[model samples]
Target: VYVETGTGELVPASLQRAQPALLEIPASLDAYLKSIGDKSRNMIRKARKLGYEFRRLTPEMLGQDIYEIRTSDPMRQGRPIP
Candidate 1:
């Protein structure tokens, strides 16, 4: 699990409840869609139709966007956000 931590050094840790899943990023979005099943592909298409998009946050968006995203989940990783 490559979950990001604030700490710089690598430290060993364990979670009481963890369902680690491995995901592979295909060479292209079309290839990714092709790899998934019919249901998943449909769900992704639906989200796209709903105007949901995938974009990397720029430096200018890092502050507020990250804050909003992190705060939206009251509990993250293994602790409370606040």
Candidate 2:
């Protein structure tokens, strides 16, 4: 009654067609930094020292920001719609 594609390769085939992209979540910040390696860790530390705050934005918050970014493009020639 139901079919699911891209969920994962539930059954193995002689010629496999697709595999889902899997994201691994780190248990802690130390684990995340270790996964990314030293250079990326240093860069992230520097960004934080420079007062950069990384966060998630809701759709409501992104709506106006997205519109502004899209319309601010000089190549669009004053057209608000992309």
Candidate 3:
């Protein structure tokens, strides 16, 4: 099991596991692109070349699109869809 706390606080001290990612998005896309490593940047470039454009999200506009995008693949990596 995993337990998380603030920087100094800890409960169970003996078990130290790798912490899960905490994403902190930059204010702009360019700033974000600059922050990631080269391999990730290359993937983004390839995605852009393949015409995968970024869409600004809105409650009514992107709900269906997001649903289709996420549910299109029933199995991703080695896990089954929830």
Candidate 4:
């Protein structure tokens, strides 16, 4: 079953849980390829060549980077950002 936000479609019974929820992906073997910059993609390829499997951090971690960047802006701190 699949679900998406920002749409008014009815939920499928098969996907319905006993509690409120958001959609989630269980896992994927190629998870490391998602949400990556070009440098990280190259690093992943190198690691795989060396018999290492890279794991991508969750989008929540990416959100943390955005949040930190926003909060740390010099203009946001009430002074001219030099």
Q: Estimate each model's TM-score.
A: 0.47, 0.63, 0.42, 0.26
Per residue, candidate 1 scores C-alpha lDDT tens digits across 1-82 of 3445687766666665877898877999789878889999889889999999999877686888878898897998889988
Tell me the tens digit of each residue's lDDT in model 2 across 1-82.
Answer: 3334597545544644688789999999888888897899889889999999988978788998887887677566555554
- What local lDDT does model 1 show for residue 59? 69
User: Worst lDDT window (10 residues) for model 2?
Assistant: 8-17
Candidate 2 vs candidate 3: the lDDT winner is 3
Best by TM-score: 2
Estimate every model's Cα lDDT from 0 to 1.
Answer: 0.83, 0.77, 0.83, 0.70
Is 1 or 4 the stronger prediction by TM-score? 1
How would you order the candidates by lDDT, starting with the best? Answer: 3, 1, 2, 4
Q: lDDT at 44 for candidate 1?
A: 86
Cα RMSD to the true fold for all candidates: 8.6, 6.5, 7.1, 12.2
Model 4, position 6: C-alpha lDDT score: 66
Error of 2 at 10 (Å): 17
Candidate no. 4 TM-score: 0.26
Q: Candidate 3's residue-wise lDDT over 50-77, tens digit each?
A: 9999878777787898789779998888
Provide the global lDDT of candidate 2 against the true structure: 0.77
Instruction: Judge candidate 4 against the unseen true structure and give its global Cα lDDT, from 0 to 1.
Output: 0.70
Residue 52, candidate 3: C-alpha displacement in angstroms: 0.6
Query: What are the per-residue Cα lDDT tens digits for candidate 4 across 12-69?
Result: 5465457887766647736645755789888878988999865688878699787777
